[model samples]
Target: MSRNPSPCLVPVSHANGMDLNAQLVLDQKPIRQQQKLRTLTKYIQSYPSGWKKRFELAKLLYQIGQWQQAIDELSYVVRRQPQVIEARLLLGHLWHLTGKEKNAICLYEQTLAWVQDDATRYHITGLIAQCQRRWQTALDSFESAVLKHPDNSVHWLLLGQIQLRLEKPLAAQRSFDRVLSLKPNDVTALIYSYDALLQLHQVKTAEQRLQQAYKNAPSDFRVLLRLASRRCQQHLVLDDERAATLELIRTVLRLAPQSAEAHHLLACCHVFQGERIAGEAVMQRFVEQYPNHPYGWYFYARLLFQLGQVQKAADTIMHCYQKQECDREIYRACCEILPAAGRLKLLQPMLLEMVAAFPMSWSLWVTVGRVWVEKFNNYELGIAHSTRATELAQDQAAAWFAHGRVLMLAEHYAQAIEALEQGYSLGNAGARLQTIAAGWLEECDRHI
Candidate 1:
């Protein structure tokens, strides 16, 4: 009689095949992943009740961004093994990633009930609170997490961030201090602590924290930028601090040679130091290098204006407008600069083009109307454009106020009062506009 075969050796061939398929998935290359999927499908078909194989397949699918397929596989695995906490947690994470936050929260809450470990419970509570934007709840959960897992610097950091959002700067500073105690070279904690200290008006202490952060990450652009800004705000009478500010800006330029922000800050530093020619040169170079960037063009125009080149400034801003870089600041700058250059006519064509391209822009229509009525004394054109603005943006107080002002200027007292009263009723017409409308209403009553 032969000895009974060992139980482990009975399924050695199947075990080796499964191991090979798992290894192929681990390779993570596209071709290997495809091969692994095919092998896993055949393996599952042969052993239809294999939840472990299905879970492995789900992980690989997730790595490849096949979210729905991953979800289906994980769902099957969870149904087959209801006690598999890891699978349920991963399914919940997928739900959160796909923006099904409520589903994720439900799963996480269920998992919290099953988990006995305080650390796991606290982590799940923190995740739920974060999804709800309940900052105080998140802070309490993170505080508990740090208490249970005192070595976790990340928990402390998150707790500090929540405290900051809740406007308890002192509490936030204390939490950041704990993070720094755990990790002295934590640059994020250093920076955040500095901010909290500044909010609390502990200026000297904030400066020390910032210095420590700089020493830890000398080449960090954000740190350099903040340091330079703080120096500028200090308005130092001492030459050393002023020189240090310039050096910080120079270092930023050196570290990020192609950075437009660095160049912008450098130009500003030069201007602040009263080196107008140097500032102009730097700003001009920035605009040349990054012609499509609106800020570079804006700064360059400002430099031209400062240099008394009003016509050049107007031309630069007009070019910006032609490129469709129109914002409130750009419009305001053009209104000021073009008039000063005695070239208000240069902007009329641009404004007309803008309104034609963007017919729904109420503010552009108002600008065109104001330019006509105030700058050129063209009352008929002004009234027509302002009327068009009111039609397009009936709820906009600016449009109503502008129309009322134009009607008042045309000496149409009754119509002006109607428009002005409509604007005043909107309640969000800014203080200046409201004051002018009120005064104009009095004038209209006198005329009536």
Candidate 2:
């Protein structure tokens, strides 16, 4: 009759030494979460959510870009619950969207360290590497990420970009292939593939691919710029094409006025259009705009040389050389426009003096050979000079071209063809030079 001794569902003690439920002691998280959820639900149900709502408060403040308040609430939540990856992720993204890249990167790295998922970690690592100019590292990171998130086309596109920077076209092609497979309408991958194919000299295939890419990515500036670069590489002197190139450059300038390479390329394109004055103006603007840029003085002097401003060009280039001018490219460019005429004899001698002072200068040797051999048409001396130049500048097409011209003039047609063909492969081949070399080759073939 003792009421069957009521079942003991509680612990032996409580706040008042009374029985308490044992379940609460073991499962505290559910109780806290339930309380929080109930409070949140009550505030949400009542429209404005009042002071009981922390998450909605943070969200609302964030929507209005009241970042300080949102940051305070978010920071509080993170402090209260350090395991909330989503909150950290959103804050990191917000920091980046607000242009606080350094802070964003710090937070992202922290979030990535906490994130257990391999795919997400890979993505964050890739982004961080890319932002730091660690391109090879980025490539490796993206490759692993793509393996984890095979369906992520964005990762594939980014991987292709890293490959392109590293100049691994075959690897790049595979990355782009995956991007296209996942998202057939992706413009970036298609355009990049078109450019990579063109570099391989698969002209027909590149043309078809570019046309299709352009159709899909009609308004893409990169596609247009790349196609324009192809036109330049073709080196046509078409008036209409030149105009189009100029227009494309104008459009690019409008979009990105500070792009140094864009300005330089457009200025070079002007030479083909017979707009030398306009070209000079654009190049001058480039110099003014990018005085610290390496190519500015180089292209400026080149334009000046083409316009017959020999002394000024030499003097301008000399100034640049005085300021850490160990750039082989700058030396080569200077040689192209140093004006090796009777009036400029002293300049050539001065350059020869430079060559004497720096015997390792393949460019100076190439210049020496051009003056002694090709331009003066002194066959034995030219051959000797050219042979010396070739010894120093083995892979230079200009040296080969000058040497081949000397050979052709000396009736060494077979040797001339061989040298000229080598020059063509190395990019000293122009329409005028090609016509001459082809004529010499034909003559040699006839004798054979």
Candidate 3:
């Protein structure tokens, strides 16, 4: 379900463990192979005599996400050749994945009987303990795996992932370091390593890791999104990161041809990039594909309004709002998009309908205050709504700001000063809001 790449395991072609070759013994340490010893085992069930082929097939099936089939194949191999430790080890893992926790632990125990290689046994032992949620035992198992096969980057990374999950930051970082030393271009290890570094506030070091990651896998979405989110010391405004992120998302769009979320991210990027039209081109496809999605209506409307296409924008909102399945978010969105007038004629009718449909939402109350104060100039109606906004929000700053602004317009100078002071204290009033309040406060001061 994670469409994004795991910072560790990016999509490897063939879904077979990356580029496995004869060097697996040297590379991954397949030294526990028992081809001759396997043939000597007593067959308790009907299965092929060659345990290695069975192990390979099981691994292949697991790689393809056929956990059940892999379990079946490995179970067959293990039943006949009880001495095939690798087959039993994988069967334990399959059982764990299949939600058979006790069964998985039993397979690991059985595997331990045949596996003399301390490293393989430790690895299986760790995994079984992991299934049991005995994390400390899992640590002991992976630590043993490292002792036996110190050069196995995969084992090192697995250790790091577990350490990270357990919140052992220093230990996790050390494991990632070993993993990186073995496979210098290992992106996943590097990413997790950066995370550990970031948590320690070793930001400059973490940044260097990010740069290293970008150098290694420039097209990877994990790196790009991290960059977009600007995960580090100084928080950059979302607007500042928009241009590069928008372009990065466009590349993702090229890779994933039909992702509404990707399209939505692009639209958000456009909001900051100041390229409303280019962003809209992407949203148009998402809108067409997922018409029922409220965000589809939400985004396209914002873009159209920003593009000065107010009529079209209004029509889009109306289409979503009138539907039976529409969410309350549509009302909030309407409140958000309404302030972008020159679209008021289009906004007004729709807002009236929304107010009628759901009168109690805080958003609708806010909209009513804004509309009466700004558009209708009906000071009395504005005060009524503004009062409600204040009451609903427990007289919070923005509510008070709205209430004060309406009071100034209605010439209730005494109350306006109190409300404005409350708004100013909360740091909620905008410059325009302050200006109006200031003028009224000064008038009251003079009268006093």
Candidate 4:
């Protein structure tokens, strides 16, 4: 027994009657993790068949965000012991996290064959379908899982989410109700039930659910934001209600000091109270704090626009675009601000990128077409984009009008007249649009 010491144990001589447990308790997480990894590596090398040690190492890697390394170790463990359901499940989860959702689905499906427990089998089946975005399949699998294990609140939550995605709000409401019954005051269930109730037009019930969520999770920023938004939307006759709503939003800002959403909400509250200057100051502070947040700049730009500082608003939009932090809203704002500030040609590239990202958005296509035809005099490019817009939204008067305008620019008089007529007949086209279409149609007829 005295011949060799175990590699896994701390040396007893160095212990010196001291408490190793107390020493471990004082050590930092990284130090403790290093010690564990060394011990596990030694054990794994000493025993080649030690799949348990490999699994432990994989979990440690996962905890430290070494996802690819964790996947490697998990791959080994699963290969060595294919029946290890937990390892297989974790491996699938890692694959999903790494954006290899198809791989996760395949692995989970294979593991389903080995899962003997009805609940686990159904759960894994549900996970496979979820990874594929096959909501119906996931719904069926989670429904069976809930039937097999009715007490699992998590399973019920998943079922409810699937039903929501599938647009079966009534079924989602029932599933979320089960989750609430199992764990009363469940914030997720409360929030989701509120959504379901809203979809079902049960306004009173949804209000009650939102109140319950706020009551249960007053400190939660999401609940506070929701409550504050509802209060802001209502016509506040009472000073007390308006003050309370403003205070709720302030609390959110205090909790999440750098949250762009909280800052935006605070600025909007000020604007709602007819305090545009104060709202501008709040948005300025937000952009200063979160210079990289695209929405922060967007909110600031919008405030500047409302204050009649069109040039400054256009500048802010340019800054956001230069940072390569763009989304649909940012692009749309660019299209508006640049044109209003007499920088219409500056929007050409942004419009192209926006259309690529949102190809099905007829408004974006129309914007692209307008820029190309009006600013760059590229009628061919304009016609191509406007044609795609009309194809994507045949019923949209705006889309048809845009197509007709592009055709008129390209000197396709007959096609331009036909498109303008179609748009004028749509009736719901705005007065400005109909007037412009009529003028353009007359111009095209004169040319022909």
Candidate 5:
């Protein structure tokens, strides 16, 4: 029997514009196998109806990276012998590798209908769910697979991964534990288990797991990077721990010199350690190296802001915004710097554009409303933006409070009282905001 073709043989298009067929021709092969392939091609041409010979030719084509030709031959074999399960599976795999996921899924579903084995059925169902990105469905399928074949560590590992994606950290930890039980010292399982622990906020346990992983695989870049990030996130005040964190990050950089994540983390460490000059230099280099990386620019801008270069910081952040790298952090940073720099008038047009772009962002709307009310004294425009903020974030106490304050300033006492009361009822209004709202309400009542 011919060996099953390795999945790694899938052809990848290269940057140099050389086609897969050209690469195949350039590949060196044993002379005997090349001669045999030529002979087999001619033989298959002579006996076109020979399904067995055609299947053999398909496997050979697959081995030699002739994916399209292999798929053609396999399709022919499956057409002639519809019950050939191996050939059907190979063809489906080839279809998946060629990016014909729908066709591959159809074939897998059809095979599942005929397959009596529960394990195979679950595996196929899991594959279909994965193709659709239905994490819950994949989790169900993988769980079923595990129930039928409890010894399969691969199934357990996949189940753990899906559980993690679904944020079922405890369930993922259980699955990873099962995987580790089956395959002791599996590095991937260890890393995933550590992640699950971290998600559960079991920080100490996660640290212990990381130490074990580091001891087991000292040179593993992923383990080193995770350890460094965890340490940095702890915001360690002790000198020794901070020094160790820096050392770990530097080691990761040495191991993977081109790692963007390592550079980002190292820059963050510098900022955390109060080394602003070093942080600025590292962050500048990082953004230059990875201009498309939003976090790089975001952090660099933060360093600039700290160094009192408010204008340059604002410019860097604006660049990030132009690149469509708008997130909560970026928006919040802009809200802080623009107002402090007394550039609210200069930022008004951009804020309006951002509000349009991120209509759901209550913060953006509130910022625009505040600018209109405080900077320009445009009461009508301020009320309009503040009302929109309240509409977008009905549950946000800050939104309601802001709207109510604007209304009171506009001297719409009744509406202001109602808005302030609504803000008070939202239950998260800070003490200062609640007191101000109460004082305003008293003032409104006096007006009434």
Candidate 6:
């Protein structure tokens, strides 16, 4: 009466655990796997207390990329057998993969409460901190992990990635080098080390590392995307080199159709090829597909700006801002596009929001001051923001320049001169600022 011939054949009950695992590993056919899954379900229905069978089922679901189903089984195992730390860890990882970072962190924290092993504790702590973007905490935890287990390449790799995020490129390079020493030609380490090398100004060495990454993992989407992006940077013109870069980007897109970086690179390739319409279309589709992706919207707006659709660009930026995607690039684009399109009034409310969002952004404060003074003639607000900028970054010439500009706009010539002089005194640190300050000083002198 039944179509499935192996309904009663559960590997769990009849076969040894070793044979069950071996069968799961060796059977590559989907139909056979489905049959096994059905048999396992029936076995579990008969014996609801079979945590081992459930865990194995979860693992099999994970292998087949049925993440949600895997998570359900893992959660069931954890709820029933609270001592199963393995199930909890896998469940946390699945939560992270599903973009439930807070849930993952909560689960990891619970595991930390009962976890006794020093290395594992540190590793879990690092994962929690990494999810929260607490770079220093992650760095400390990963540092302890590497210290406790110097031979662990994964530990070194994590430590290096945190160092890179912290902008310690030299230290990151050393950590990545350790990972390479432990596991040579590791594509992840090689790709990540290329970033460190670039930050260290070791451009030639960076290229070599990237080349090695390509050699090690030609099919890896990250490697392919990185290779294409690097080529795009070096070959900006529409020549043979640029065409080759385009081909590389096409390959990356083929491999990873949903990759944001690949889509952006393809758009850039179109721009380089002088196909502005094609570039615009690509970015438009990208933003449509990934509306929550800030960079995609940012680039789409930028393309709109380049295409002479100033009003449309401003509208795009405003929409992005309203969506609460307060990325620095979006702010920069807003600053550029808004004033050019006479939409500074629209930027005013967003400026206050940006200040609250990024209170420590000295450049943003400078822009805030400039906008208030230039657009609204509100020198009081301008000077307040400019003063805050200078207070936040006392050594930054741009901040001092912004302060001077606001003061001059307020007709406080003497105070403006003093601030400009301070900015000019910073020399090479503010070389361009010095020229602007000198001109403003001459203007102030004439007024005084």
Candidate 3 regions exceeding 4 Å error are 1-54, 144-149, 219-228, 231-243, 250-448
TM-score of 3: 0.45
Q: Each prediction's Cα lDDT score?
A: 0.72, 0.62, 0.64, 0.76, 0.74, 0.76
Clashes of each: 0, 1, 2, 0, 0, 0
Winner on lDDT between 2 and 5 is 5
Write down the TM-score of every candidate. 0.40, 0.50, 0.45, 0.51, 0.50, 0.67
lDDT for model 1 comes to: 0.72
The deviation in Å at residue 351 for candidate 1 is 30
- What pairs collide in candidate 6? none
User: By TM-score, how accurate is candidate 6?
Assistant: 0.67
Question: Residues 278-317, candidate 3, lDDT per residue (tens digit)?
Answer: 7788778777775555556766776676677766776777
Model 5 Cα lDDT, one tens digit per residue, 121-166: 8977987887665656888999999999999998899899887765
* Greater-lDDT candidate between 1 and 4: 4
What lDDT does candidate 5 reach at residue 442?
93
lDDT for each residue of candidate 2 in 184-251, tens digit (9 for 90 to 100)? 76666788888666534456776777887777754455655666666676874376676777776666
Query: What does the lDDT read for residue 435 in candidate 3?
Result: 74
User: Model 6: per-residue lDDT, tens digit, 1-448?
Assistant: 3121111111111111111110111224557778888988889899988899999899778655577789899999988887788888889877766557888999999898778878878988999987776767898999998888889998899899888765466678999999999988777799889998876556788889999987766666677777888877776547767767777777766655655566777877787788888988898897777666555667777778877899999988888767654666688789789988998778878788877766656667878887788778898888888888888767656567778888898888999999988876754233344666788999999999
Return the lDDT, model 1, position 411: 73
Q: What is the lDDT of residue 195 in candidate 4?
A: 85
What stretches of model 1 exceed 4 Å from their correct place? 1-116, 236-243, 253-264, 275-448
Report the candidate with higher lDDT, 2 versus 6: 6
Q: What TM-score does candidate 2 get on C-alpha atoms?
A: 0.50
